[model samples]
Target: MSEPILSARAVRKTYQSGDRRIEVLSGVDLAVERSETVSIRGESGSGKSTLLNLLAGLDKPDAGEVIWGGGLGLDVRSTFLGMVFQSFYLIPELNALQNVLVARRIVGGIGSAERARAKDLLARVGLAERSHHLPSQLSGGERQRVAVARALMNQPQLVLADEPTGNLDERTGDSVIELLLGLCADTGTALVLVTHNAAHAAKTSRQLFLHNGVLQSAPKPIQP
Candidate 1:
């Protein structure tokens, strides 16, 4: 078998609340293989987002280690991974196309090729006509679509999405989830999604529930 794209080795995290130190994650382990889609579901405040932050290297674990298979070092970290969040973190001044191109900032200077790639990604996210529109001009769903395009702009091997659909309506959320899964599958990108929606979670190749700061297998839902 091939090595995983990401692995969390007995991760542990804690936070101080007044005089008490609350343990958020206690020795959690996870591994995501290439081109695989994995969804994590848990109760609110179950440390789902915290686990993602740890996985993305945005936050350090109190114990254990996160190993990225690519081993690209800190300099190329942006190239090795992509990320999506509950809030659409687009630049208000930039258009949808420009927002996507921002992901290439670490790569090199933007050129015609980069611009073209950004356009293509915007189109893939169903926002081709709105490519020139600013985030302020877009609807909630449209904004999130732009965020999705931006996440894939780097052609990252893995994407860590935390509540990507949280702000959208049910129908819109469902569509976003579908698009995210399709794009990852088409690009052969590994995905670790943290969501609260059961139906959305079931769409992934694997599902796990985070309980008591540990991950447990979930019964595979029937595929449509």
Candidate 2:
């Protein structure tokens, strides 16, 4: 098999809320290979986002480690990772083009060519015409599309998306899903998506259920 772009072994996490310890993950393990699409599905409060945070190095596990490109998260550097969230977390001040460019600017700042690349990314997401619009000016789906383009701005090896379509209508959400999967496949970027929508999860190459703080294979085909 191809080497895994991201992997977690024996990951454990817990939280203490006023002396009440809540265990979220217990020895959870995951592996995502290059250009592969993996979906994580679970009921609410199952800690799916927590696992993603650990994988992205946004949070650390009390035990175990997350390895990316054969190195720890910090060792891998932020440029290797891209993130999209349920909410379109676009900067209100920046326009669509600038929003995408901001991602590149964060890593090493942008040059003329980088600006051109950002435009291309927006075009790919079908937002080239809306490139000058602000978040308030765009519709829900358009904003999400902008977020998707920004996630790809860094050309990251792994893209971690948390409910990318959660806020959109069914038709718009389907379009976003197709665009996200197609872009990942084209760019060879590994994708790990966390969503409650089984029909959406079914489209991925592999589906895993997060239950009781552990990861397991989905029981059967997910009916739409």
lDDT (tens digit, per residue) of candidate 1 on 2-50: 9888989999999999999999999999999999999999999999999
Q: What would the per-residue lDDT of candidate 2 be over residues 191-211, giving only the tens digit for each residue?
A: 999988888898899999999
Q: Least accurate stretch of 10 residues (summed lDDT) in model 2?
A: 70-79
lDDT of 1 at 218: 71
- Clashing pairs in model 1, backbone N/Cα/C closer than 3 A: none
Local distance difference test, candidate 2: 0.91
Model 2 residue 112 distance off true place after TM-score fit, in angstroms: 1.6
lDDT of each: 0.91, 0.91
lDDT of 2 at 3: 77
Weakest ten-residue segment in model 1 by summed lDDT? 69-78
What TM-score does model 2 achieve against the real structure? 0.96
Backbone collision tally, model 1: 0
Per-prediction TM-score, please? 0.96, 0.96
